[model samples]
Target: MPFRIFRRVLQLVLCANALRVYLISHSIRRVIIATLGTALLLQVAYFASVLLLVWRAWCNRRAVEGTSQRRRGSDYS
Candidate 1:
């Protein structure tokens, strides 16, 4: 099973490399432009997702801290 999986993955890598070569040879300019656009969009999406997750985590942490502070204040009283 592991050998089969490795063989399949290797095949896919070879096929992808062949297709990349063909694309680059066919129209390098268009390929470069498209690749850059795709990379930029991917980076923007990744950063936005990360920022949103961090914001949510920060909010949750702040809320937990606020609740703990209230509990401590009540305990002191």
Candidate 2:
């Protein structure tokens, strides 16, 4: 019974090692790297869009302020 238990333990260890090796194979590594890179790219794009929106709002605010100043100056003249 002890020998049978030892055999089972050894089989489990071998199976675990095989799984580990398969996970660390080149194709799997490439898939993991690609997934991470795509995620990073998406994050950057989201930030870029947020930055663009803020920039547009700032420009619009500046334009409105400039127009108001022009109107006030024209009224004084």
Candidate 3:
């Protein structure tokens, strides 16, 4: 348990130092940040498109099912 805590503390210190250096160095940070941002934007766009398609498909399936159910009930009456 003690060793685990020590490892975590060491990792935090290293991350803080790296972040400070990244902030101090403008050019490298900008390129890294821009690439990450673009990746996130593209992910959001892809997710939205997939969700819209699934929603349309669900609605179409429900409509078809509802009509078939109505037709079956009418024939039995």
Error of 2 at 29 (Å): 1.4
Instruction: List the lowest-lDDT window of 10 residues for candidate 1.
Output: 9-18
Query: Against the hidden reference, what TM-scores do the models get?
Result: 0.63, 0.63, 0.61
* Model 1: lDDT to the true structure: 0.70
* Backbone atom clashes (below 3 Å) for every candidate: 0, 0, 0
Candidate 2 lDDT, 1-77, residue by residue in tens: 25576457655654565455557774756555555565566557657877998999999999999999999999999
Candidate 1 clashing pairs, residues 3+ apart or interchain: none
lDDT of 2 at 43: 56
- What tens digits encode model 3's per-residue C-alpha lDDT throughout 1-77? 25577457655654565566577775766656655665566557657877998999999999999999999999999
lDDT of 1 by residue, 1-77 (tens): 25576457655654565568556688766656655665566557657877998999999999999999999999999
| Alpha carbon lDDT at 28, candidate 1 | 60
Against the true structure, what is every candidate's RMSD? Answer: 7.8, 17.8, 10.9
lDDT of each: 0.70, 0.69, 0.70
Give the Å error, residue 12, model 2: 35
